[model samples]
Target: MGYINIDFTAGCTNNKWENLLHTHSIIQLVNTPTRITSTSSTIIDHVYTNHPENIVETVVPKIAFSDRYAKCITRKINQKDMPCLCHKQIRYRCFKNFDENNFLGDLNKTSFTQIEQIIDVQSATAMWYQLFLSVINNHAPIKMKRIKHVRQPDWLTDEVKEAQKKEKCLPKQRELE
Candidate 1:
């Protein structure tokens, strides 16, 4: 079995727990700066590894969704070829640049007289539908747009950002007893 790592969200300032873990040959790999809180500096989260050599680096990113800073683990692994795929989506025209009067005028200019002249009912219905579609497509054309996905919480607001900034500014503190 490989080494396992755990993160404790609750503020843990005591070094005694680490000593106990080390006594059992468990090594803690969270080597970043001191954990910051709104009130004080503490190491709430921890990363433990049985095979320390496998861990290349550990970092606590500034951006996070909660009070606990995100812990990132870097390890050496064999590289393999990966396929690059493009993800595209259709973006329909919005009313922002659409002029109602111009759209109505365009619709008025559409000729549907040929639909009534068709002898077959199916042909007339198809012609009428095609005319309607052509008018709409000319007015509100759909466009292909590519989107990049970002890892961010939907509920993250400006207030939460401010708080994260404040916590990040907290000074590095000495190991707690």
Candidate 2:
């Protein structure tokens, strides 16, 4: 939601606005002050959502583009509704505990006679693939893992978050000066 310029935290204006929103089943998500000065801090900016339970998190990042901090909300995605947002399940062979010597010994002991005896080229190729797969499976078995995809910006880090906390105080510091 955009700036209503009415402080929703105090007075009759706040009560009327809150009553109207509540009647319509809309809830204000932001609780922190959106704008701050050395003398005062007020919540002028707002975000209203009907499905409050769907909201996972809300943030007010103090960006320098405006006096008011940016309001953002992350909603929980339903896998059936948003297939693209669902976590991916992948199958892979993990080689973390694979022993090279054991693998080599197994490889050396394996018989290639069945593949050699096969007359058809396709059959021989299939047999060779199966034998190779068996050796690989014995050495490093296939594993299944679920990977959750996050949408955070690549540049966002612990250092950047700490810097933003420091940056938020700069405006008030300037006003005081």
Candidate 3:
């Protein structure tokens, strides 16, 4: 056969595209794949068109939302020993915001993280959509409460002391056995 050209999205001079309603409906909030609890194959129903099939599989780009994009997922894996293959089986049908390739610098914002089923956070793309990812041991939760110090008044100093004594007596009563 002779050389043939294809009008792929990448060929477009302006990087622009429209999100289809079908893709939007399948995903969960934020337009991510909602397959974990999906009773049907709606999540992975291969979308096919009459366009000529392109055997070539192009590489997809990555995007990060949070500033901690690089370290989004710190997965422990070893080649010698078989590591967890959970990430491999979890596939999401979220749409990419950037060009045909991938979005860059929107860490953990994909719909895949919002799935009801257990989704792996180790995938490279998952790191890019960190906003949807659940917090694990790797993340340090910010303390929600603050500590307060009680001040004593000169006139009520005796009352405060009496309360302390009563509290101490109650504890002693428990140990009195």
Candidate 4:
């Protein structure tokens, strides 16, 4: 992709830059004017791609920073080529049957004398860690499960979804008020 700041609509004059891009088999995708003002509109920002066939759609979103709009391109993707499309295996501890009183009783019954007897600080820490880990594992065992991964657009986050829900409810809220 190539973006150059040149007026592409200058009275139908032969554009050397465009001609150069054509020579290299590159095609300009954006036809709409990128920069617009009250007096005039011009295609100052350009988007060029060599593999135009792979591009599914080209959009010039109406989000203005200055006078220029943001350019977006959607490309065709193969599902088999994406590893993220497959179900992923993950291990997690299940705490559904965990009892706080039972866990506490087991912890209290556990002997820490072996750990205390160890003169080395590292070995004592390791033994202490292992003792706690064993008790925790017995109470809440680790299980593996496969989960399907779903992909969402980068701009559509949890916060954005919440905001959208609130926006949808505004009309009803106003009517009640």
Specify the highest-TM-score model's number: 4
Clashing pairs in 2: none
lDDT of 1 by residue, 1-177 (tens): 112233333553346766788788987666553356677654455677787887888887877676556778897654454333455463544455667788888878989887777887755665676677577666676565665543346777889779656534432211110
Candidate 4 residue 8 Cα shift, in angstroms, is: 14
TM-score of each: 0.34, 0.44, 0.14, 0.46
Residue-by-residue lDDT tens digits, candidate 4, 25-97:
9887887788889998877777777988889998888888788888889988778776775688866679999
| Model 3 CA deviation exceeding 4 Å by range | 1-151
Cα-based RMSD of the predictions, in order? 21.7, 21.6, 33.0, 18.9
Error of 1 at 111 (Å): 90
Whole-structure CA lDDT of model 1: 0.62
Worst 10 residues of 1 by lDDT: 168-177
Per-residue lDDT, model 3, residue 116, is 40
Between 1 and 3, whose lDDT is larger?
1
Q: What's the true lDDT of residue 18 in model 3? A: 21
Q: Alpha-carbon error at 73 in model 3, in Å?
A: 74
What is candidate 2's CA lDDT for residue 124? 70
lDDT of each: 0.62, 0.79, 0.31, 0.78
**Model 4: residues with Cα > 4 Å off, grouped in runs:** 1-13, 16-47, 50-83, 150-177
Better of 1 and 3 by TM-score: 1
